[model samples]
Target: MKQAKTPFQFMAASTLTRICGVQATNISELLEQLRRVSTDSVFNHTFQSLSAYHFLTEGFSNDFAQWALAACNAPQMAEQLAALDIRQYESVEDLRADLVQTLESFVAAEPQRAQQKAFEPFYFCEAVTVTVPTDWRAHNLREFCEALWHVSVHSIHYHFVSARLRGPQTNDFSAWMEHSLGLPELADRVEHIDIYTNTLERVRQLILDECIPWVES
Candidate 1:
């Protein structure tokens, strides 16, 4: 059965296709997502929260800074948000308001400031997915499973960043991998693993063992 179309999934899909020629399901579907980043309240709040995290931590924490950059979704906004003093806002609400105001003013200042990049997702996906070990893509089952695990990690990052920017998501890496990466049987295998009951290593092993027949076929 075709899964129900979700507002958020389509929201993400439309944004990606319009900007990078990529969709949540495939790189070919080029529908325009109706939601614009500038008007997305949740995204703005994510930006504010991430900025505050960076500012409160004094930008000394690489992990916090990276999340802020991901939340920003653009180099220009990341640099601009990094320079702002978020502590002065005193509360998360204040900080968010200020962040939104600043972003709104920035948008007003330059209406044509390359807004096409707002919905881009592939670059972020590739950036996060590349953290896998160099040899993890070997043809062996163990390596293949490790590679799939890396892809799952990448999907988690992608979901996190997108959720922060777009709100909660109803999709998973399994369907995403099959639709976006063109790996159907592998995706079905991945979707069956229970991350809640099993450790990541265990889940990876399960996927590998289960996928052997698929690979052979």
Candidate 2:
């Protein structure tokens, strides 16, 4: 295996979730808060919630959609919110705008639904992420696969899911593979792993399933 020009450094992150002092009891209030809340709050509820709710085989993958169904008694709105593909968004602002628009459109069509109060208020929150470099560094494909097996699920989420919001590339692993190792085909495969549907551990397994064969070849 050829050594990478720039070695891939494995990193892990721990999230500290804090209440943002914003709460919404209905669709209208939720839309208001969505517009004003920080990008971290939007990212926390949508992208970060995926890891927390990864075992979900049905329904929505995000907190807003889940809340809309369970709390607000709005199944159609829930479907609309859940239908948002997070991958299409490059920034949390765009995601937030879409979220706001989804709710606005839904309310406009069914005006009565906006005032329907939830069983419990949806409290806005933000993630305070602290990332640290791990000891594992991979200079080649084989070492990269080895590191993948041992790194924590947090590392997988940090490098794969959360990385989308941080850079131009889809994820850290694909960027390194394509740019540093010159394996664009493999990089494309790794970049397509669905984070919304699988657990972090499952995501790790999927990445390994893609890379291990290449390493062995």
Candidate 3:
């Protein structure tokens, strides 16, 4: 009998989409289909969908992409995705999940910027006004993290933040929070929190506490 391939062994994004029967000839079209079936605007809102496209097309096979497409096209198969939660995995069993290696690499490579809430789901839900899926909770973590990363790290919101630092946007999640967004008072409270000197968890908490409240208003 043949053994199953691991998540790390998956093919590139373009190839995966084609194998899944999507007719797109390029990454952009593939993403459109992905968005259509998934019904999420987070990627479009951030414009980092292109960056993700570049990553998957080049060599990296995003585990989340596998689920995203599957959830959009074949909802029944999504239970497979649900079984492999990448939330706060701590050991071999955690890594033993289908997406274990990919999630480990992903979390390890996280900019270590924010106290990221490990994703619980593999699909999008928050920004959608449509009727929520019965399986929405299962895929919430992956989609939410993807959306948050694009907004906080890859999108024009992040770009504007980076422009103020006059450098790579990756370095200044805080600068933009202090200067551009709605939390000036909160920014003032954290203005002196040294990104280098203080713990990353602390910094992330400050940002989350100050920034997330504005989402409701």
Candidate 4:
């Protein structure tokens, strides 16, 4: 039987196809990849794997940032949530090397701004969570998993708002973005994503306001 795909799945698949030219079949494959690989590996492998996809879809000169954001399963991929499945990467070592190289290039390309952004908490968390070993820091599998969870949430909210706010509804790329963010049309714009943003805001408030503070206090 051909199972019906969810909104999130469809968006992610469309985003991948539009940006990378490779049809990932479903978001489940992407999520499974997220679960099984190390953070660094996932981040790096994503670029390496999708570069070919993008080359075929959009010419080489086109910016790859949006594709990266899309592949990261940003808010635009919301409805696609499915049961997480497990898969394995062939080379952890290679993944790490590629991520480090990518970071280096990013820094060299844009040193001042990149460094400033790197100092921010969320980016710091991302660096630590994804590229821990490069920093000569070691985290157990459980810690790494927790880090991936945090990064995934942050990345989704970031891209959904940023990307969806810019494009046309008819475009395959921009369609689900609005639904994912649940934004009210142009009249009322969200001021802050982490705090006053849709479901994420409620989630953050719950975790910070009720849960963490209560536990800490």
Candidate 5:
């Protein structure tokens, strides 16, 4: 088995949620707040939402989509928001721009929807993440798979979904696999896991499944 050129240190993370003191009761308010809110806030609502509600079996994948449907009674707008493919965005600013544009288009088409009151106000929030090193470090593919099985789902989210905004690589695991282990095909498979469709636990399992054959080979 090929050993990694550099050992991959496993990491675990936890998020501290904070209210940014911005609230939106309707689409118009949401659009205005979204334009001015910090990138962290935009990230929290979209990317972080995957981990925050990882166990969700149904409903929209993002907070904005859920709020648009449940609170604002705008299913069409909700669908549009939910349809955003977060993987396409390399930065939070791009994600925020797309979010704003989606709402802008919706509001323009149905101006009455802008004034519609939500059942509960949408409070903009941001996540303060604290990532710490774990004792589980992998020098090879087999060790990596074993350590991955033992890490918390939060760790999976941190390395997989959240890492997209932090660097040029697709994710921590894929990058290490391709660059450190010289396994581009396996890395690409790991990177292609559809985060939007699967729960975090499911994501962890899928990653493990992908690594199994490579480990045995």
Candidate 6:
């Protein structure tokens, strides 16, 4: 019988240690037998944690691409991501850089920016009129991206909060958004708190790992 491969480690010494050029039968042996390897053995716990954050940020960016493609039929961005092999991004900063580049390319190819139109088209029964863009532009890419990210994060937060607060009865985005952001709120709703915590944690990780490194560079 053959031995099974180990489950992928979220944190694995083997991950960094396993080199392609090494001549060894097993990962463990490869690490042990290798000589004269250039290893930077800095015990910067903060830096490692920051790397994890960058990984998560890239993960989130991938997720966002999927969502955008599904919701808006904008498969170009997603296709570009896959073509770029962004999943193999060496570091968090690399992932962030690629994501920004992908967005920029997409925007640059667009002939025009989506002018703010009446929010009436998107407004459902519970949705209030909020002017929204139908498409994205590359020129003012950063500002557009900021708005896109803000809406998505808050949208999820509101959705979760509504599910907990309004029971199973509420079925639409409008109702959920209103109730979630509405007046007197209670402590029992786990969705709002949980989602916010998770999202912020992800954001903080991205900033430390991806943003800081890029800024320093």
* Cα lDDT of model 4 by residue, 139-209, tens digit: 22222223323443333332232233224322211232234323223112222222222243343333333
lDDT of 3 at 197: 30
Q: TM-scores, in order shown?
A: 0.26, 0.95, 0.21, 0.20, 0.97, 0.26
Mark the regions of model 3 whose C-alpha exceeds 4 Å error after superposition. 1-182
lDDT tens digits, residue span 63-149, model 6: 334433444345665566434432133343444455456656555565242121212221101112122333322122233224334
Provide the global lDDT of candidate 4 against the true structure: 0.28
lDDT (10s digit) by residue, model 2, range 18-112: 99999999999999889999998998999888766656656787999999999998988899899888877778998999999999998788778
Q: All candidates' lDDT scores? A: 0.37, 0.88, 0.31, 0.28, 0.90, 0.31
- Model 2 residue runs over 4 Å out of place are none
Tens-digit per-residue lDDT, 1-217, candidate 1: 1222321131111111113222322111111221222223323233323322322433322222233355334455545544544323324344345544545555566555524443433221111112222333333333443455555433332332233233322224444445544566666666555433444345546666775665565
What TM value does model 2 have?
0.95
Q: Every model's Cα RMSD, please?
A: 16.1, 1.3, 20.8, 19.9, 1.1, 24.3
lDDT of 5 by residue, 1-217 (tens): 8999999998888888999999999899999999999988898898888888988748998899999999998998899999998877789998999999999998898888797888999999998878899999999999999999999888988888878788755999999999999999999999999987788899989999999998888
Worst 10 residues of 2 by lDDT: 50-59
* Per-residue lDDT over 66-172 for candidate 3, one digit per residue giving the tens place of the 0 to 100 score: 44333233222233433342222223232233333433343345424112222333332222212112221111222322333333222322222212323432323
What's the CA error at residue 194 for candidate 6, in Å? 33
Look at candidate 5 and tell me the lDDT of residue 58.
86
When summed lDDT is taken over every stretch of 10 residues in candidate 1, the lowest stretch is 25-34
How far residue 215's Cα lies from its native spot in candidate 5, in Å, is 1.0
Q: List the residue pairs that clash in candidate 6.
A: 126-174
Candidates by lDDT, descending order: 5, 2, 1, 3, 6, 4
Clashing pairs in 4: 8-79, 8-80, 9-80, 20-53, 20-54
Off by over 4 Å in 6: 1-61, 111-217
What pairs collide in candidate 2? none
